[model samples]
Target: MNVPAYAGPSSVTTRSGDALSLPAPRQDSEFSIERALHERRSVREFGKTALTQDEVSQLLWAAQGITSRDGLRTAPSAGALYPLELYLVVGMVRDLDPGVYRYAPAGHKLMKIIAGDQRHKLASAAHGQDCVADAAAVLVFTAVERRTTRKYGSRGVRYVHIETGHASQNVFLQATALDLGTVVVGAFEDDAVGKVLQLPEGEVPLYLMPLGRP
Candidate 1:
């Protein structure tokens, strides 16, 4: 269960010289898990309200936030080989610039990858799904197969996908708790998504969850 450390640069600068430090995630939530599960639904439509930075932080944290000091995430992984990587396509988040950002789970920060609104392009890649473009933000889950394959061989691919499901479900529950809406989108041209995110080699796109106020 020896997961390798993340290989990307610790941080990246925006055109405005701004760093990607996110608001501290609130540990205490009034929303109960039972309520979250009961209220959770596949919401394809979204309101125009912009999400707050704190909301974004909580959502990311729920998806893959570091829970233990030893670098374990909120979601379980096969052999602790966490192959899933999180990227955000932000559009209308308050106090945060719209751009593509990679989540650093260990550090609880985001690294800017590309700046500008790419939601429209992402929507096109998702077979013209308006939810991808209309939501305030989209969470893209990608996986580096070798992270698990190096240990479990071809069967590792299944492990990676299973892990992503766990993470995506975490987002769904969290969004419900936050009174936001989200839908897990698996219909997309994989290659098209990779190009839109400018993903590095060894990474493959898996799931896209668009989030916003319902």
Candidate 2:
């Protein structure tokens, strides 16, 4: 849609920067959705090439962003109660700055939490996964329990994970199509990630996906 400039740190408007207008991929992509699914693998090793702002925008859009006029999302939700909140831990990217941002799916913007590189901390939190540091960006998915729990009670927890799976699959497919690499990390210090993202008490971290050049 729109591509907006990110005013660094003190001027950080939202989590992740606003989507910027950039060149779209060629008519032919590296992989189709079905092909991507067939070829998908957790690529822990990454090249030094950094992701561009447009790539980040496309990735977030594919994940859980709103796609419909009524704010309907790309990922399915239980009872249509969307409980997932996405965050971006940017380590290295070109044509933009780096920081920990919250992905505002509706506005397609980012709210910065902390500035500078913190992949080491994320790697440590993710059970010493070097990929967290090697990858250019790490996407953190959090769920606001009340959104679903109010309807499905404790069973809502399962739905949240299912919804996260949908969102993660979107990222994986998008990565494959864009010729990038991605890895999902389940082990992490939830409280620590929440601290890093400045999440509220009811918001719980669920999944972590790192993206980079393969």
Candidate 3:
């Protein structure tokens, strides 16, 4: 098994002024995969406390942080053509402004796309699921199909879905390790979600993961 390699701040060279630099992800953890898997559950109830930036960083890192110098991420992609994009709907994170932010795994940083908390709107878009509104932060997963389909043709669509499962599961396990509650939510209107994130054309929303202290 290829584990996620940690690339500290010293290794991150490309970053824009607007992007918030993330803390280095710790590879060593007392929690083991077997334990995380045994304990992993779909968490809907969450605490009102705000999440720390380090927790946010670890979660995002598990989802899609680059694990190697060649840009190989925590999750594998078909043909190494990563089509997935991660967006965060920030609500109650410490020291972080509430807004819509995009995660760039290459630099392990967040770029603000929209200002203010939009979690309520997102919950509405998610068919009024309270979990979406209650979590301190929600990670929205999107994909540009053409990145994979352009090469694999019709079958590439399946590859995108498989990649999504891989990425989402990583978050689940990482959440368990951090003692955070998270659940993968897929029941939502496509158009509504795209609008909530103001996603670009061709980027399809695949999953909504609301995360916070249980």
Best by lDDT: 3
As for TM-score, the candidate ahead, 1 or 3, is 3
Among all candidates shown, the one with the greatest TM-score? 3
- TM-scores, all models, native as reference: 0.91, 0.85, 0.92
Steric clash count of candidate 2:
9
Local error of candidate 3 at residue 33 (angstroms): 0.9
Clashes of each: 0, 9, 0
| Clash pairs detected, candidate 1 | none
Model 3, range 1-214, lDDT digits (tens) per residue? Answer: 2213322212232346778888889988889899999999999988777777889999999999999999999999999999999999988787678889999898799998998889999999899999999999999999999999999999999999999999999999999998899999999899998988999999999999999888
Superposition error at 137 for model 3 (Å): 0.4
Tens digits of lDDT, candidate 2, 11-67: 322332344233322234546678888878878888767777778888888887777
TM-score of 3: 0.92
- Local error of candidate 1 at 124, Å? 0.4
- Model 2 bad stretches (over 4 Å): 1-31
Kindly report which residue pairs in candidate 3 clash with one another. Answer: none
Q: Which of 2 and 3 is ahead in lDDT?
A: 3
